[model samples]
Target: MPIIEMKQIVKIFEDPKRKTNLLAIDHVDLNVEENEFLCILGPSGCGKSTLLNMIAGFEKQTSGDVLMNQKRVDAPGPERGVVFQQPTLMPWLPVWENVSFHLKLEGVAASIRKERAKEYIEMVGLKGFENHYPHELSGGMNQRVGIARALMLNPSVILMDEPFASIDAQTKTDMQEELVKIWEKHKITIIFITHSIDEALILGTKVAVMTRRPGTIRETMSISLPRPRDVTSDAFNRYKRQILDLLKEEGELAKAASRSSS
Candidate 1:
């Protein structure tokens, strides 16, 4: 059985002005396999993030269901860890403390937390800056801390919401490489959300192209790209162009909807 399943999920948001309910997601069904790296790619408001939120158990669907390992998901648990766009770290806490925050919540001792955080800190290549605050680190470094914090939970599934979107090109590439390395080493299942075609192509085993507002699954293209994906390679460009065309189709539909409403 698929490790994660969403069966005909639907989510609607009521708009007071339109006096209408907007369907953010529509009859979306997906099955994610074990240790698979999946990317949900679409334009803004396509409900990619909303789908991730549902899997994280932070949001509920208007209808249908979400299941993991044959059990219904009703609430957030340590088995699933999410890294939002922003770091969301505790400003007052040091790097190690932030990474070990979950353990603290579980009433683990300071020494134990410190030791556990140390291992993840090193995993994300943030060893020497254990004493630093969030403000002290660069954008990419802070994001690494966010990832490390999530890893410290030892969650089997890691959900990322455009986690590298805020960093510079160079730093983003570095982080992406490191993330793939981590995924390979730990064999963790990752469900990533992004608007960037290149990011999706480079990272995912399956690239799930989503439709525009009232989002639905348009296609789930198997990447088949070899690891250490070269963005400049011909194969990479080939898939990128194909995915771009798919997204363009969604964009045209969105424009038509806007014009009809206007």
Candidate 2:
């Protein structure tokens, strides 16, 4: 069985003014296998983040079901870790403390927590910065701390919602390479949300493209490109061109739908 399954998910948000209910997701179905890097790509307002939220158990679907390991998911659990757009670290705490905070809350001893945090900090390339606070680190370095914190939990899956969105282009590329290294080393399952097709292409084992508002999975295509994918290669461009066409077609359809509704 697939490790994660979303069967016919639908999410509707209420508008306070009774103007109209917003259907953010419409009957979307998806399944992810173990240790797969699945990147979800869509235009803004396409509910890509919403889908990730559901998988993380931060939100529930309006209809259908979300299952992990053949069991229904109703609330957030430690089995699924999440890294949001921001590091969301405790500014006052140092990197080691932030990475092992959950363990601290669970009444783990300080020595054990420190030792455990050490493993993940090194894994994320933050070995010597254990004493550094969030403010002392660069954006990409802080993001790496967030990733280490998530990995500290030894989660079955890690859900990322554009965790590198705010970084510079060069920093973003470096982080991407590090993330791929992490994934390759640990063989961790990841579900990432992004608007950048190139980023998705570079990271995911497969990319799932979504439509605009009231988003649904338009298609899920396997990358099949070799590691350290040559972006300049013919195969790479072909995949890029294919996804571009899908996005363009979806954009046009969304605009037409809005015009008709108005």
Candidate 3:
């Protein structure tokens, strides 16, 4: 059974000054299976983040339903963890403390929280830096702390919104590789939003492309490339070409729409 299901989801934003309702996402249905890494790909302003927000329960859809594990998602819960573009860590706390903040909220003892935190810190490859502050770490290290924090919750799913978009290209690649390794070990469901075709191809087991604003699913593709994917291989290039062509077509359609509206 699908772990996450969205049926005819729609979102609209009201503009009081213009007396208009801006349609963000059109009726869209999607399903994510257990242990699946699903990447949502789209152009800017195409409602990819909006759709992810709905799944995260940060925003409610105008219509339709979002179901996870056969339950309706009406509010945010520990079952779903979100990592935004920014790490958003607490500057005052040390690495281990930051990772165990949620445990602290639940009134867990300090010794127990620290013990639990250390395991995840090591899992994310941040072992020796447990006592360091966020300001002392690199952007990628901070981001790993955020991931560890979310994982400490033991959530059934993880939602990532272009978490590596701000980092340098090399760091981003390293983070991607680490993420894939972590996912292989944990086997948790993840819904990641990104505009980069290469990133999606590199990370996702399946890719779902969205159209321009008033976003709808353009296509859903299963990636069959082997683990430790070879970007230079013929199979990799073939998939890349296919995704690029789809995005190019959508880009032109978006341009035409803008011209017509003007």
Estimated TM-score for each candidate: 0.97, 0.98, 0.98
* Tens digit per residue, CA lDDT, model 1, 1-262: 8989999999999889989988899999999998999999987888999999999999999999999998998889899999999999999999999999988988999998998899999999999999999999998999999999998888989999999999999999999999999999999999999889999988999999998888999999888888899889999999999999998988898899899999
List all candidate RMSDs to the true structure.
1.2, 1.0, 0.9
C-alpha lDDT (0 to 100) for residue 184 of candidate 3: 94
> Which window of 10 residues has the lowest lDDT sum in candidate 2?
14-23
Tell me how many residue pairs clash in candidate 3. 0
List lDDT for all candidates, in order: 0.93, 0.94, 0.93
lDDT of 2 by residue, 7-60 (tens): 999999988897789999999999999999999998899899999999888898
Residue 245 lDDT (model 2) = 100
List where candidate 1 sits over 4 angstroms from the true fold.
16-18
- Residues 127-205 of candidate 3 have per-residue lDDT tens digits of 9999999999999999999999999889999999999998999989988998999899999999999978889989999
Backbone clashes for every candidate come to 0, 0, 0
Question: Which scores higher on TM-score, 1 or 2?
Answer: 2
**Model 1 TM-score?**
0.97
Regions of model 2 farther than 4 Å from truth: none
